[model samples]
Target: MRETRRQTFDEVDLLLDNARLRDELEPYRDESIDPSINRMPLHAENEYLASMLAWERAPALPIAEWFNPPLDLMPPDSLSDAQLSSLLNKTIERLFSKNIVLRCTDHLSDRELYMIVYRDILPCCEKMVDVPGKAIEWMCVEDTETWLRYYASAVERRRYQEERGMPLPAAETPPYRRQLPGQ
Candidate 1:
């Protein structure tokens, strides 16, 4: 899929909101670390990773439909603001919306966070967060940064293996560098 930095006017608001949310969520991001590198790798489940991989391949459709879709089909536009908000919140929660639990704490590397956010969080956010047009550009930036890190690590691993003349032993563990958010 083509990498893009396009953002609509409304996306600016979404971007700001997302930044704020990130700040609020930061304190609660993952803090635990696995000390034993010998244990099975803490790979995020494959289905979650697969979903993120699929997103990379899918055409970039307008995020609107995935966000605040038209409610004409549901016929509840006339509800009171409080009621509507409550219902929307429920919908958002049920849709697996991104929240404090999903944010990346300093504990996880950027790549790990990227996998968690894009795979587990973004898809859920699709039905919950009303993304601003500008945030789309930010998302693009984040996505690109994540991809580069993944690519770099893979390349480094292959290089190490070639030089060592053996499949990478545990000591060849690739260093995990956190990709800066939206860099």
Candidate 2:
């Protein structure tokens, strides 16, 4: 219940919590943790240790299973455009609730995004991290054309072309734009 950021080395709760976390993280210790955390205050170090332990313990499961009863979607072809759009919005909300974010989505149509969520995202196994504000950003677009055009800026495209020695796709407007969550 005290203020968070200025936590001094005097608090018993923090010290106790840190002790527990240190023991729990002993087996899962990263070689670089000591050097990275050496400069931080004990409270900050405790938080870092806890997050590392949380990630270490997180289960790799299909994203849909993060939902209670698991999120099962009907085939995108089975639904009309309006139906698909409505369902997609609701599904995005559900995914956001479980800390799963969809990125690079503007390039695809409603049906295309919906199918990706159904076929690609839901079944894909990912670490369900317990860390707050740490969401899994799932990329919705697979096409390089879409990435170069809508997502990347002209300068970035040019740099990418130079680096990869490949033709850059001309940048263009994405067909469908929605005010989706966690954009």
Candidate 3:
């Protein structure tokens, strides 16, 4: 009789199991998931869970280091409207090229967005890990008081009242809209 060269049924099952485990972990093995974690015993039963645990334990890095070239932004007030607009366009393009998208761009006027990009985002050294399948988002990070006072729509203000159980204050017109760039 010819000697059999086939894997045992149990061996095939183990191989399939390992493959499934790897597939489960595949989405988490990106740049944001620190590679320093031990990934030995490729056939471990809990490999997927281990990878997630390792990611949770990884040290965070500053957002500035996440970019190939660090952002060096100028003060919004220092630039003329024309210069600011030009720089804002270039900066937005640069950020988009790096998979860093600005959220709520449509909600903000040119000057508001420009101030946010210059003062809050560029100067921010916060750690913002980018997980796979999720875009890095930059948005207005102003205080709730300032946002509610200036930018919150009537609907948003009412929603905030219901959520916080606070008495709804009379909506005051934002004084900055008159000075909005390109207005």
Winning candidate number (TM-score): 2
TM-score of 3: 0.48
Error of 3 at 109 (Å): 4.3
Q: lDDT of each prediction vs. the true structure?
A: 0.38, 0.86, 0.61
* Per-residue error (Å), model 3, residue 152: 6.6
Let me know the TM-score candidate 1 reaches against the reference structure: 0.21
Give TM-scores for every candidate, taking all chains together and pairing residue i with residue i: 0.21, 0.85, 0.48
lDDT of 3 by residue, 125-165 (tens): 54443344435576553567556766679899989988999
Weakest ten-residue segment in model 1 by summed lDDT: 131-140
Q: 1 or 2: which has the higher TM-score?
A: 2
Candidate 2, run of 10 with poorest lDDT: 1-10
Return the clash pairs for model 1, or none: 10-133, 11-132, 11-133, 11-134, 12-134
Model 3: lDDT equals 0.61
Give a tens-digit lDDT track for model 1, residues 56-88. Answer: 444543222344552211224455555654554
Ranked by lDDT from best down, the candidates are: 2, 3, 1
